[model samples]
Target: MISFELLLGVAIVAGFVGAMSGMGGGIILIPALTLVGIDIKHAIAVSILSIIATSSGSASAYARDHITNLKVGMFLEMFTIIGALVGASITIASSTRPLYIAFGAVLLGSWAALLFAGHASWHASTQDGFTRWLELEGSYPDQALGETISYKARRAYYGAPAMFGAGLIAGLLGIGAGAVKVLIHDLIMGLPPKVSTTTSNLIIGVTALAGTSAYLAAGLIDPGLAAPVVLGVVLGAFLGTRLLVKLTNKAVRRFFLVVLLVLAVEMIIRGLRG
Candidate 1:
């Protein structure tokens, strides 16, 4: 049963997950809370609110690093906001089975692509000249070069679809959609890890709030679960940020993928049981 104590616990955890993934809190909180007896719709609403708080807090720190390109984030945010509203509307009216399948499929596809993709450890020495000719360069830090690295960003045009899709998924799934945003920033937009991760964080805060509004309008939001999830996630995200200094995203992403696979199977099983 949903209770004040349970709500608080989930909120704390959600905050931590947000800090860690910029958008992973919902992926963790939703299924867990639903399993405990809250309706999936209500669970999603709580997850959405927690996402806003967590993303706002964690992304603020990323902004300080300057890797979050405000220009790109603001530009893409327009589409994401619209997509989030549409997606959340659908979620309130649909079953989650389809969303679970889609989430797993995207993760599976990303895993496969990452496996075959060969990324050269290269950065553009200048942000102008050739890069300007092609409109591809962006700035980021290169640990290997021990200084700021400026590189041309390729395939920025391809990012629009991905951004739209991420927004939809976030709203529909009550998740922050950072996983897809990071993918687009890193793969499609050719952003560095810092740039991609931080920029995704910068975008999620607003995106989540937009989604939260949609859920609230539908009266699917639950203050009981939301209260604790919000509290927990904000604190958790802060802790996760500190842990980021010690871990590689590759390791973190890999582990998250495995966990998702397991959850997908579990969701499938639970559905079958019902």
Candidate 2:
């Protein structure tokens, strides 16, 4: 077994990357833990706890700064929660090999999206009736740009499925599913980068909580493993948030993509070996 201190150190770096990229620490933490001989599902369980920690730590500041769209997040929470429950149930019944393969595939998809779709501009030509009715629009200060940027959350109809998929991955893999969530919000819904990322962080916390109930019932969660993971991620997320404003968007995206590629390859190899 890996020492607690090593796990904590890994979690700290995971949380930093996660907070900066809007993907929760789990994407990094789970694979790292598994490499050290932790069971895949057990590593995932610990990852969920770290997600909660990073979310709670970074989300508060984002919300206070008015970067998170609360109404949008709440509306989408309905779809995500339902998806989380279903995904968690699947995780409990499924074998680990398939999960490893699935995770690798999903990470590959996320990497592709980051490479190709990350730069797409989102602008609604016309407000769809649903978008108008929900008032899915907002503005936030952009530190680098030195002005407030406004955006509209268009095409809620299409975004719901994406959110559901994100929740599925979150519960099944014990990730924040932030990459999928941000893709939907930023690419489909037309939210600004900061808003999309911050809103995703907030939503992930609640989504993780929903999945946690199922994990707890399935006897997958280990409090002994979770405690240090949570503590490290929480502290790391706080530091990440502090550094967010200073980092360039391009730099963050490049680093995030590298991390995803490494994890994706690792999972694929592990799955094939089994």
Candidate 3:
């Protein structure tokens, strides 16, 4: 059995990465827990609970700093919630191999898309009537850039459905789906990277809440495992929020991509071996 201290340490690292990248710590936590002899299903459930802690610890700070776009987060939440419930239900009946493969596949796809999009030169999209009506635009003070950055979101019509897909993957994999959410915000909606990440942080908590119901109903939530993870992630997430706001967009993107690539390969290999 994994020692409580060891699990706490792992959770802390997972939380920090999750908060920094807006990819919920579950991506890291689930793999670590499974390696420690925990069942994937239970690891997933514990990770889901920890996601709420990560969001709670980090999202508030981002919002208070005005880095999070509340309007965009709210609009997208509607789709994500519905999708999360459905995805969690599917996970209950699914096999672990496919879940691992799908988790890795999604991360790989997001990494590729972001890499192609490039690190610099993020421009606001030409807003259509629909996007303009939805008012999916905002500005934030970027501590890294030392200026106020203003941006307009475009293609809400597409972003909504994409977010649903993100939420589905989140619930299915016990990841916050923040990576996929960030990709949608950055690529489809044309939001800035900082905005994409911060807003993703805001959206993930609610998505997790929706997904948690299914797990709870199925009696998969183990309080003994979840307690240490939640406590550790909250601490790590608090630390991550402090650093993320000070980092440059390019730096943040680089960190995100590296983590994604390493985890993607690891998960895929594990899935294939099974």
Q: Which lDDT tens digits does candidate 3 get at residues 1-274?
A: 6789988888888778766754557877787777777887888887887887777667888899999999999999999989998899998998888877887887788678657764756986788899999999989998988999888999999999999998898888888877689879987899999889889988999999888888988988988788888888888777876787422488878877887788788889988998
lDDT of 2 by residue, 219-246 (tens): 9988878887888887777777678842
Distance from true location, Cα of 248 in model 2, Å: 4.6
Q: Highest TM-score, which number?
A: 2
Candidates 1 and 2, the one with greater lDDT: 2
TM-score of each: 0.81, 0.88, 0.84
* Model 3 / residue 72 / CA error / Å: 1.0
What's the ranking of the predictions by lDDT, best on top? 3, 2, 1
Weakest ten-residue segment in model 2 by summed lDDT: 117-126
Residue 228 shift from truth in candidate 1, angstroms: 1.3
Off by over 4 Å in 1: 17-23, 96-122, 125-145, 245-258
lDDT accuracy of residue 231 in candidate 3: 89
Which digits, one per residue and each the tens of the lDDT, describe model 1 over residues 105-170?
Answer: 544554454444455443433343432454544676655768986656665556766798889988
- RMSD to the true structure for each prediction, in A, is 4.0, 2.6, 3.4
Q: Give Cα-based local distance difference scores for all models.
A: 0.71, 0.82, 0.83
| Clash statistics: count for each candidate | 21, 0, 0
Candidate 3, superposed: residue stretches over 4 Å from native: 17-23, 107-117, 144-147, 240-266, 269-274
